[model samples]
Target: MNESKHNTQFLGLLGQSSTFISAFSVAQVCLTWYVFSFTGSAVAVGLVAILETLAALLVSLPVGTLVDRLNKGMLLAVSGVAGFAVFLILSFNVLFFSFDMAAVLMLAVVWGASREITRSAGLSALPDVVTSGTIAKSNGIYRALRSSLESISNALAGGLIVALGVLSGFLFSAGAYLASALFAAFILLPFLKSKTATHPSGQEKKPSMLEDLKEGFRWLVARKGFFLLTVSATFFNFFMDMIITYYVIYVAVGINATSLVYGLILSALAAGDVSGSLIGGRLNLLKYSGKINVVLFGGIPGLCILAMGIVPGIYTAILFTFIVGLCFGISVNVWLTTAHNIVPPNMRGRYFAIDGALSSISPVAIAAGAAVIALYGIMVDFIISGILMVLFTFVFASMRSLWKLDGRVHKERPANEAT
Candidate 1:
């Protein structure tokens, strides 16, 4: 593709996805902070995460199948609409009806379902929008923006809660979601719909749900790198679950942090994530070289944890968290790009869906592990999660030799060259 075309597509994706993802991250941080403030329990915060992931899992199978058969753009728009409604309802209840935990949980489920569909569709639609060569940069830019947005939202959310109160914060979150829906419909969806809508003549009929599921599984099994990448992602998911579900809460309890301080810590980590992701974009780190780095050196986060666990101070903890966040951002950009590159364009949705479903199961394990942490404390959990990550890093680094798999399995062909 020409430079002009590439830039246009990149800008379009940036506009729509940035708005939705920023708003989504803002809402999530606000909700989590609110829940933590209200309940004063780490387990409660963990439960919210558990519920969200469970809801995503429940909706993932059908949504994944539907994306493969339908226009992914339409699906993304519908997801935006659903998300808009959810935020509106939550806003109304929180602003007027007394913001109860039950009401919040209900909205969380709605948000979770919308998140599952939108994420799956957004990922699948990428190949329709950008040339293969730019896909890694695309992933990098998306993740970078997402991380930055989340951090900015966290920073603003802390002040929003202080100045306007929780109700106003929730309402503001609703407005952001509404804007996201509008941007998605007018900008991103139209671009994608034009490319992905038609069924090719003599194309086989859409497969049944079971058949689709089986086909996705068969495809994954046949592709060794893709399969290992997914498996590594599962372990990665567990480590992240620890960070998101337990780390902040640990900070709050261990350090007796104020709400603003907690927000600051989160924003700090997000800032690291943003930087890492953008660097990834410039480096094209989603390529094979970047992924190999994950296997060889990803133990940096483990070392960070070892320091945090031994020192156990707020400043040290925050620094450790930030380092981990940076490493995670790099790891995620490489992981997403590698996996997406492996799948056929048409099967991208199903591939990501199955990936989501498989990854979803890890949260259950994470929640169980959280319970253990609650009893045994984070010292144990931190050491164990860190060690596991280090081990997985080595395993992933050795995968090429062990599995006899080449990284460039699904090279992205230029759009003009498409037959």
Candidate 2:
């Protein structure tokens, strides 16, 4: 009975991610197209993207605290329910009325809030339900399937949008959110919170939110060289956001690609994600060459971005996008797995929240970047992004802590192999 219950919870957990993400992925493509078509300005696109993510940056720190204080499972369910409301309302507005930018921006806040709630809670909730032996396999499966779903969704989104209109995609997103919420609602995981967990010294008194927030930062810095590396990691997100925000503009304004071509490129990117996850997980090579793997995965993608800018052909752009996705797949799988092992379960929520908050700052940086691209052009913007990405990646690799930490980590493993 216990094993059966665990299986149900595990599946529920996967369902929460698989359903919401896939739906959102499809909706994302449709929404981007809608916004670009409506405004025809890259800056406006950036503004919309900024609004969508702004909530995550603002609330992540507190979310770290709340995740520790409250029931994670309940929080996720509530967030999913909130997502249901956000999208459902938007769907109705689009179908019955018209596409109001003000309404879209306002509803985006609620959508982002819902997304923020699930970001850390889902990962932190994993250990309680999944046995230690299977956590690694489960995570790989989760990522691979998530990427696969994104590929399928992106591939279909354009055809679906043309066939059924963007409004239908919004409705599909609403349904998917509801389904995910229901799945999370029934997941019976004992991923409970403990007050004594705030500090390493086992203090009986409960810590304030400020204290919890500080502990997260304190722990991140304490982990060898992760503190500096953490800051460097932000550079990746900064550039990544710039790319995502601008790509839609470039495709629409610069190349005049049709919706079909746009969807194909996005699908290629996701297909690479699927390939990277599968190929990267095939061996424990990353465990030995952690820094190298991370660098290659990250740096090479920047080069791809550069090539796309220089060449700017449809086929080349699709090829480069796929490489970018492939690299992301390998790097993400490696780093997330490493983090799961390195960080303690008690601190996972806070730590992930802090990391998320830092990474979420990408939107702000990309806003400034958008200004530069406005002055120059899209091709030049890609060239600059590629150069800076590579430079920062190597700078991140230069940190001593990563090397020492990797050495210590591999040394601690019995067989020096990632299970």
Candidate 3:
């Protein structure tokens, strides 16, 4: 009975999460593909990404503050509506005009900002719905499900584009986003309707937005483990950003892959991520904390990256990349769950924002990495990045004092205690 109830609640949350993610993933993939096809320049794609990241960086702190101070459900709902509006404007702009790249970039930037806000608010609201004891597994399941849905959605978008055309694909994506907004609006149906079991108290007299943001900053800085972890993880994030921005281009140029192949590779990565997320959730990470499991587990990806570079054939590389994806899925879910465990609930949004700001701005790194790859070679970048990520995992895991949150006062109270 307990398991059945857990499944029911989780599935309900998944319904809302999957819908938003499906729309976001599909629209983003279609828009990016449309731009790349039109321009035929990886640099152009990188520039648009840079603009979007810039928007996210600027808006992240303010959005985090809002998520901390305001009603999280309303904040999420407003962001969804804003995202729908942004997509509608983009669709109209492309439909009527000759498709100006500058204008399109602006729209994408706006969309990125909305996406950042929505994500921060939604994540901050999650603890209110689920207990900390289950947070790790819950996060793993959420990551896995979201990745799988995104994979399917991107594949569908590719098929739609091929059958109809880029214009129709954009329109379809826009409609899906609008539908997502409508779903998000239902979040206002009241506590009786949604009925979350976990709710942190003292939110009614929450601090001002600025104070909230400051509190988060202080929490991170005052904690030794968190500060070190954040600094170390930045390098890993930088490399991952470079990979996300350039992997499509790598396949297109190096492997001479078509749109279908691109979509397939993406799907493979997402598949790996899905598997990883599911497994990570079920794993006994606590049993092996500060052990070699952290680094050795992540070694799965490092080895996969090496295999991909040396594999020779596109099919073989795809298989290797899928394995790499699974490792990435595990690495991200585990790290996030671990961080959430260590950080206070009120500070999660701020720490997530800082993570977002660091990870989100990789377009500049993307551009630089691309240049370096072109000048030197893609294999070199892959090897160097994979090694660095593995190294960081080890270094971070060894920070024993920081890992325990010695400075911060979580009070170790029961979950039933009021905030």
Candidate 4:
């Protein structure tokens, strides 16, 4: 196919994938609320979060290898199908049988695994879809669209949960996953057929899974600055997860807000994300990425969180959270764009998987955060998290090598043009 046609098909597939992801994101919000409401225990919510992260951790390496060896389109489809099946079962059980925490935890495992696979496939497939020059723009647009949809979905889901109850939310999520699966199977698979076939024939020797994983890790280790950046991000993620795990609880239980109010606060965050992503998509990241990262990642978010904690009212908290999301949206675009430009296309899957696993230490963080909340109270936990976040960012930014990452990365052959 011609380049324009190929790009069109790729964008179309990505759009569909984003739509499915937005729905899944909404489902996650609903599930979080449901779990907390049903159990009324911060520890229970923390356990659910931990279990989900553990599932992702267990499959990270294998999923990375599979993303490289298998058809990415098929991987995406399988992920959606798995999600659909699990949620459908959950919905049925919720409607017909008792509310089983065990079943919910089991489904969390499956859902988490599927989410990791889908994310890996998408990251690995990006280079095949767009030119190196447009990676940042494409990623930004994708994130913006996803955030916009998520905002709407979250707003709607809050009302849905209140109006129709939690079971209906699960049913809607099941349908969303089914639609995602259908889109991947029918739309994306056709375009990827040729790409998949280009791999070695059945008779050709393929590296062992262990070797493939080793190669991925080696590639990552060779990039010292990027590796360190990932480490810093992992730390950042650790604290961020703690805050997220208890955010709903803090707003609903601590601050005494309704479910609808909580959803609106979340929606405000997503709205800010949408705005930042749109702006990020259009900026010349090659020129100003460093400044953007220093401000957005290193400075703004921590301040926002700190302000949110100190502020007295829900509206003030929402405003601060919105600012945090805006910074996060821009920072994430810069980070992903830089990574995509530097990493070899063939190794993106493994790179992303390893990075994900490192960042996915949320389970441990959540457990810790839960304990802290139980002892120190939510307000104190937020203050500590914010302070640590600021300290980590300062330490990371003090590294001269990290500040020069964008310049050094531009010197390399871009990933999309690698092979």
Per-prediction TM-score, please?
0.88, 0.90, 0.84, 0.93
Model 2 poorest ten-residue lDDT run: 407-416
Single out the weakest 10-residue window by summed lDDT for candidate 1: 410-419
- Model 2, CA-based lDDT: 0.74
Error of 4 at 350 (Å): 0.9
Clashes (candidate 2): 0
Q: Write the candidate numbers in order of decreasing TM-score.
A: 4, 2, 1, 3
Q: What is the C-alpha RMSD of each candidate to the true structure, in Å?
A: 4.1, 4.3, 4.6, 3.3
Q: Please provide, for model 4 over 1-419, each residue's C-alpha lDDT reduced to its tens digit, 9 standing for 90 to 100.
A: 33423576566566667757766866787888888888888998888888988998889889988877777878888988898898789888877997778988998999888889988888777667777666677777778888888888888788888899878878888888888787778877777666552345675877888998988777776666677777777888887777877888878866888888878888888889988887776686655555566558746777777767776468887898889889888877887787777776667788889999887898888988899899988877777788888887778777765655662245654323311
Mind giving the per-residue lDDT tens digits that candidate 2 earns over 239-297?
77777767766676668787778888888888888777776555563353357443755
**Alpha-carbon lDDT, every model:** 0.70, 0.74, 0.66, 0.78
Candidate 3 per-residue lDDT, tens place, 223-307, comes to 5544655565566667666656666666777677766676777788888889988887778654333232345344556666656
Candidate achieving higher TM-score, 2 or 4: 4
lDDT of 3 at 339: 65
Best by lDDT: 4
Q: For candidate 1, write residues 1-419 as lDDT tens digits.
A: 43424565556656657767766766776788778777877677777777888889888988878888776767777777777787678777765675487777777788888899988988887667777777777777778887888888777877777777766666666676667667667777667666663456787885578888787777776655557666766766766566556665666665666666666777877888887776655664434543544552356877776566566777887788788778777766666676666668777888889889877774576686677677877766776667777877777767663234334445653333311
Top-scoring candidate (TM-score): 4
